[model samples]
Target: MRKILVVGAGQSGLQLALGLQAHGYEVTLMSNRTADEIRYGRVMSTQCMFHTALQHERDLGLNFWESQAPRMAGIGVSVSGPGAERLVDWVGRLDGYAQSVDQRVKMAGWLDTFAQRGGQLVIHGAAVSDLDYFARVYDLVLVAAGKGELVSMFARDAARSPFTRPQRSLAAAYVHGLGPRPEHPDTEVARCNLVPGVGELLVTSTLTTSGRADLLFWEGVPGGPVDVFQGVTDPAEHLALTLDLMERFVPWEHARTSRVELTDAGGVLVGRYTPVVRQPVAHLPGGGLAFGVADVVVTNDPLTGQGANTASKCAAAYLRAILDHGDAEFDEAWMRRTFERFWAQTAGPATKWTNVMLGEPPEHVLTLIGAAGALPRVADRFANGFDDPADFENYFFEAEKTEAYLSEVAGG
Candidate 1:
């Protein structure tokens, strides 16, 4: 049996472990978490897993679909500005629905399933202080730790990347009692409030089976003294300021606290972490035969909501490379294929999306909006991002497409 050790119990790690064990490898999944340690609490910000990801789960025979994951038909985007609300209904539909299960459920499910498949799950309290041990014991060690401290082992500093510039900062809070749903028919919708010369704020209403709706607010600002986490000194002051800001500019879907009957205190706020977008590094540390995988090495900004999806894709690609090479001479071939495939297939798209979010809205956005409203086919392609890479790729470069669509609107 070929022994392989996977660190981290997140989605990417579980997916990689599951993929490897299924191929008859002796896999040991280690994390500092026990089954009971898993929490069912809701994540601060709800993210949409693209249809492609859902379809991938189905293809792997995972039961994500039967779990009541909502299939979002299209996105109803409302751009509020000085004039009025320019609402454009983009009729995009997914082949499979993007499920909004919290990261906890998603990770726990994958880990539990892996255990059932004869994979070992170790709940060790100590960190893996030495990679040398894994080098001696297993044929390989895969680090899917996301953005944990373990990344420092193999992180490539800014000096390495071609586009080595700092990333935009973000502040996100998960709040309850936001309000009732918008009158729009689609789920997974986002409202972009453009603040003329300052910056833009994008708010999305999270779709949960629970009556409680998840409210997410994202804003862009100059690299000065901006608190990315609603960083007010007093809790009372923070809640009041947030409520006031939402009412004045970003009209939330529903009431702030009146609608939900949750017992949690109104002052309970989930603030976002500082947004320091770094060039994700993946060089082999220790000069060993092993390498890092996915976000542990490279991470895209959450604005694109592509981090989990990108990590999963990388896991899939790495698994294939490992299986193809088998046990003998595995390390060298794996690293070469891993970096090559990631840079070629995924890196370009991730970078494109990140840059778009950081920069100002292009004129093409207006054009694409009008075109998508008039054409449902174009809209459908826009929504099925997880399954259709081509469509997903187009969404990142929407500025160009928007211009073309605008010309059509003008001619008509």
Candidate 2:
């Protein structure tokens, strides 16, 4: 059996490791975090898996949903502007899955499954100091390290970038004591509130064993005063100010509870460095010493609330590529094929959706919206794109749909 070493055993890391093992590869995962450390804690940030990504969980046959699973029948979108409010509710069902999953449970469950299947898990704090040694020992060195120092090596060359600027930084916090309104049980169903001028924010009901329900808030405050994130001496005052501002400028209509108990005691701050990398490194030679793999690739902004979903899809795509290639020489052809598959399957939609949420909507977004509003079935598919990635390439980007939507928009 080909032995694979997966670094940074977080959400994406655990998914890739488990997928590889299930496909008959011998996988060993190493992370600085121990199981004990992982269990008693919530993850670094709030993550909600899209319904389709939940399908990814099912495809792997992982049973993380048995004891606790959150359900979303459909999504509600509230778009507000100065002195105006528009509420669009799409009651179409989720087809076959939950719209979101708690990352803490998902990772913990994944780690447990990896161990149960005879895969090795190590809790050593010793970082991989030598990529050369790693490449020699493992058939493949998969870096699932999130946005960390390891990503520096795989930075995309500036000349190849397609975008003029990097992604704007985001600050998010997850907390409990915020519950959805009883009438909007369906609203607990993932929803995105587009506060055009201020910023876009995603609020959802998190599923967890902890009786305390959690609400996540993410904002894209460009050049705002909250730059010195963790440096703030009084987080309570900061949170109060943020809440006050949110109440003043934005219409968070559905959320019944606005006051949140921030669980991030360390005063974590979310800020993005521009240029989110249109092209991430596909392979690293010598496991990184001679060449490095594109591990910490950040595709979509948190504004769209698709980051975790996109990451899961990419993880699945990468696993398929590795399994198809087997232990054969990791050649350029293999790398190209894998990268192409990911670009088409994951990155394409992520970039498109990010642009839409972040003010660079494709010409088709308006058309698609108009069509959907006029036709429920069409709207269902358009809204469902959040869960089904294939829609990215198949429906919205389809030539016929594009032309029709463009024509309709022009006529109006």
Give per-model TM-scores.
Answer: 0.79, 0.81
Q: Which candidate gets the maximum lDDT versus the true structure?
A: 2
lDDT of 2 at 252: 54
Cα lDDT, all candidates: 0.56, 0.60
C-alpha lDDT of residue 264 in model 2: 58
Model 1 spans with C-alpha error above 4 angstroms? 40-45, 83-91, 125-128, 157-182, 185-242, 252-258, 261-287, 385-412
The clash count of every prediction, one per candidate, is 12, 6
Which window of ten consecutive residues has the lowest lDDT sum in model 2?
286-295
Clashing pairs in 2: 166-274, 166-275, 169-272, 284-291, 284-292, 285-291
lDDT for each residue of candidate 2 in 1-412, tens digit (9 for 90 to 100) = 8888887777678888888888888888877776656656644555666666766767888656734655555555555566645433343345654444556656776787888899899775424454446767876676677655556556574543445653454655555666564546434466666555556556666655453355546465465433324344465655565555556544453345555676555333455555355344433444342222223665455665667777777777887778777558765556556766776667666766566556645656555654554566665555576676556565565558677655665566
- Superposed on all Cα atoms, model 1 deviates from the true structure by an RMSD in Å of 4.4
